[model samples]
Target chain A: MKDKKPMKSVFKAGAITSEFIGNSIYKHQTKTSIGAHNIFLGQVRADDIKGKTVSAIEYTAYEDMANQKFHEVRESAFEKFDLTCMHIYHSLGTVKAGEICLFVFVSSPRRKVVFEALEFIVEAIKADVPVFGKEIFEDESHQWKLNS
Target chain B: MLITIKYFGQIAEVTQKEEEQLEVSKGSVSGLLNTLNTKYSDLKNKDFQIAQNQELVDLDTELTGAEIALLPPFAGG
Candidate 1:
């Protein structure tokens, strides 16, 4: 259903509310045989590198680019897999370290495709999207995380 | 035409400013970077990247009035 609204990432300081992603997940499912649902949630870890404790993650993206990439990812998934529905939502700003950064949900008529679709969407988001984040540390020192 | 470009993160640090305009024949992204490298040699040795309208682009990608941004390696988890 194209009219079903896609989820918007909760880009804010502190924690992400379930509603941001839950709504989209709810819309994606219908009472069909669709046997499996797979979800991946990415949480920011308080990684301590070189004595710096990552306090928060500030997510940024070129809106135009990211939206385009999102549409492309959706299309590729439809072409590459046998799926019922899929949803991807990534935070855009200030997700505190240890909070959620991204959420991916995939549902399919069969179990096998959900796994493949989950992996595919996650990898695409990491590699192709124009999202950038700054890992802010306790001491306020920051570092960039490469897609690699 | 003079096209204004924006820089973020390490790119801003090196350029010492947020935005500036470059005069060119709406050339390729690589050509612009080359001109910038000629003026600021530090870029030649750094890990900076180019984006046109926020999409990561190859060096040879052509630019035509697109909003350009220079970004260093990302730090998002």
Candidate 2:
């Protein structure tokens, strides 16, 4: 008999799912774009605090609010930035301190706008999104980062 | 009724638990916070914050019959 994994998806899965969708949508929209595509992937760094290595980072979010905020960010980016496509994804579960947790992808008809748009969207996500991360040290101590 | 309040990050460390829904009369956000702080003295010194309905909120916000969420000054990338 084959063992079945948990059938119900949790909020953690929702964030990853949306992120995948966002990337897929961007690819579909920009299939005909004829310029540079810049992507920035934010990996969790192992910050050395008092000689302890950052073992992992735990992310938690008000999922409902996060989804709403993400949608709004997408809409505003589309309206304000002259870009062929863009995508943003963030992890909602435990991400190893050195693993990638956030990804920002942008493709545009011109390289200049794509560069600018990447900066804008990343800053907006850091400032406006309701996601939170707790850094767990090797010794099990933790500290929260204020998206700075 | 006890409304379990969940604490995270620094808040959780101070509170020593992930959640604690204390008994309070359905009241404003400030009112609920006041009672909570009065009970949890450790929360008094922490630079914590509040969230209602999954969004950060100010102190004066009303919460008569809404899902209240409390958060500390956000820490995310």
Candidate 3:
């Protein structure tokens, strides 16, 4: 039987605050079944290209397709691992350097499961999602970012 | 048929608009791309993928008059 997981909105405007991430972890305390939780946070890097330095990243996506892809990744993670729950959040607008742009959280009953599942989910997200980033230089010029 | 085409990120930057409606002849994805290429000269130099009905499709796939999108390289983490 196919896993029928409900779709959740993963896009957030601007940068994801540290307080929000802390709150998310605090809330999961009530889930007593979850013994291990692995979190991955993607920060905007201030890359220096030539003489210009990157100040921020402006993110955009094909929302309908991106949400669908996120759903598929979640389902596949569940199928491959004994995951208790998973949550993914990505920024939509401008995220300044050193700020969090993406957050992926996975919970499981065992430490080993969380480790493997976290890497799988993060890799899948980078490879599969249709999210785009425009790296803005300090001089106000921008260039498109590609996954390496 | 009239097809709604969506553009995102750098692809939208090249098109100078987010979405537009175009009248296309019965053709394959490559044919539609040719029409778009002729209409927007800047599009030819840009790198992107075509999605039909929200799914990534190859150049040889036939157009089904669905919602189409021009997507640039993904940078999401």
Candidate 4:
């Protein structure tokens, strides 16, 4: 977190479902000015580590701090890109492999802007957010995940 | 000063609790960490960052008795 002023945004519980993502896109249909939309979905990978295969990831965060960081990322994205709208959601609790855990949606008047804005926002979230993940193996053993 | 400290991810695992309050002398963040290392011996070996209030602070920064957090390497996507 970069700022002491905490911004409040509730964390989403469980995996992000396709239905939820669909509904989000459905709602955006009313914003006709947005000519292009780009999305980034972060899915849990069943990675193998030391002979153990990951079955799920349990995410946790310093919620108040994470909210504050998210606020900064959002504010900076708006300032740097001409985005018509932006949305981000990250999962708390256990998300199994193949399930979506992070969703970033960005829209703009032009295709190029949406593409660039989406990449910028996604990279910022990875580097700045305080969210942590515990990669749970099939046998119940787990290890903390690190951003590469 | 009474300081509140929070632990997350692997740091919480080492500390064995998520949050705690301690009565400590006002000092640099590293000084407070020295006290914590004595209490939680594994904390010194863990990879983490210190946050004073909610902002990330280095070890040399003075503690302000605000809410502090020990954060491990981030995995947020």
For A13-69, candidate 4 gives per-residue lDDT tens digits of 999999999999999888888889899999999998989999999999989889889
Error of 3 at A40 (Å): 0.2
Give the DockQ ranking, best first: 3, 4, 2, 1
Which residue window of length 10 is worst by lDDT in model 4 chain A?
A1-10
TM of chain B, each:
0.88, 0.80, 0.96, 0.95
Model 1: residue A138 alpha-carbon error in angstroms = 0.6
State which docking tier applies to candidate 3: high
lDDT of 3: 0.93
Clashing pairs in 4: none
Instruction: Give the number of the best model, judged by DockQ.
Output: 3
The complex in candidate 1 yields a DockQ of 0.47
Winner by DockQ between candidate 3 and candidate 1: 3
lDDT for model 1 comes to 0.74
Q: Give the candidate number with the greatest TM-score.
A: 3
Sort candidate 4 into its docking category: high
Q: What is the C-alpha lDDT of each candidate?
A: 0.74, 0.69, 0.93, 0.90
User: Candidate 2 — what's its lDDT?
Assistant: 0.69
Fnat for every candidate:
0.31, 0.46, 0.93, 0.89
Candidates 2 and 3, the one with greater DockQ: 3
